[model samples]
Target: MTAEIVRTIPGAQKRTNDPEGMRKKVLDVAEASFQEKGYHGSSLGDLMAAAGVSGGALHHHFPTKKALGLAVIDERVAEAVAKTWIGPVLAAASARDGVRLVFEAAADELEKQGFVRGCPLNNLAHELSLADPDFRAALARIFRAWREAIAEKVRADQQNGGEKGIDPERFAALVIATYSGAMSMAKTAQEATVLRQCLAALPVSGQPAA
Candidate 1:
């Protein structure tokens, strides 16, 4: 329904102020906070206050900060990939259309979210790729799968009788690289316009980059 390519769709407002509910609330709040402030910037006290939960309760959900960070990345990446990149791309008219659709949807999601959270994979890539190799590997797998899916669709289109010039394999890689790079730049500038401009410029049909 909304652009959530990079960020979680802000959950329903913390409804019940009960204890068990509050712990879940803390996790939700911490998730959003981590996305907003990064792992280092999010303080336990701050997260607790936002959650309206006590320190003991917060710790129950996550005993350590690193544990919580990994959970956040794992869950967020799965949800984000399904929503912003994978499903819709697979639903397009063809492989080329699939690639175009994903970019268009990504751009739309970023702008609709006001580009606040930006892309989670891109966010993680910038920080964790060097700081945490395991996290980086996990995220890299997601990107690779995404590119492969797009490439597969493109190959299918070619076999089924589609347009010309574009090498689906190469083009899929470019789309992934371009979109990721564009999102990173847009987030840094706090403007979706830059990424939107790049998306607008991608030809729906083009020769795969040699």
Candidate 2:
């Protein structure tokens, strides 16, 4: 039976009557699982067990594994990028300064978390981009959104006479590429130092603090 039909089951109704809550729970569990295990490595069974939901409940929200992964990308990963990077960069005085601040903040977080895993978008892109066209498109959208956000800020900074020498598009690409590469290296080495070094070398047009 479909998840909608199975939701009528007495136990299912009692446990997950709130559709939004169930969906969020599934996304939360799936995001963690996918980040830890990659898309292929994580299975529907693992999601069901981690989310404490039955097969029917899982299917009700996400009909297929690909659907679930895309939802996680659109919802969880996109929200994370907006919150962590886009928002902060937009709020900063200049794009270059924003890049510096965001990287420093991210470095602090990585240090606290021990830096074993890398960027979620990068991790998934490496795992699923070539294997699935849908995944590639979904991830490409996120990366584009992220790059556009930073690029917009960079353009604004240039117009405001902050850093006219740098190309906004090129700078944004550099920031993303550098961070993604550093995170991969950090994950491989199981060390936050790699990330710190990369952040230190970022070509942000900001002066080091005295």
lDDT of 2 at 170: 93
- In candidate 2, stretches whose alpha carbon ends up further than 4 angstroms from where it belongs are 1-20, 205-210
TM-score of each: 0.76, 0.87
CA displacement after TM-score superposition, residue 100 of candidate 1 (Å) = 2.9
> In the order shown, what is each candidate's alpha-carbon RMSD?
9.9, 6.1
Cα-based lDDT for every prediction? 0.73, 0.86
True-structure lDDT of candidate 2: 0.86
Q: Cα lDDT for residue 19, model 2?
A: 62
Candidate 1, residue 157: how far the Cα is off, in Å: 2.3
Q: Which residue pairs come into collision in candidate 2? A: none
Worst 10 residues of 2 by lDDT: 6-15
Q: Write the per-residue lDDT of candidate 2 for residues 1-210, one digit (tens) a residue.
A: 554544354555434577666888999999998899988999899889988999998999899998999999989999989998999999998887788888888878878887576789999999989989999999999999999999999888877777778788998998999988987888888887876677667777344332
Candidate 1's C-alpha runs over 4 A off are: 1-24, 109-115, 163-165, 205-210
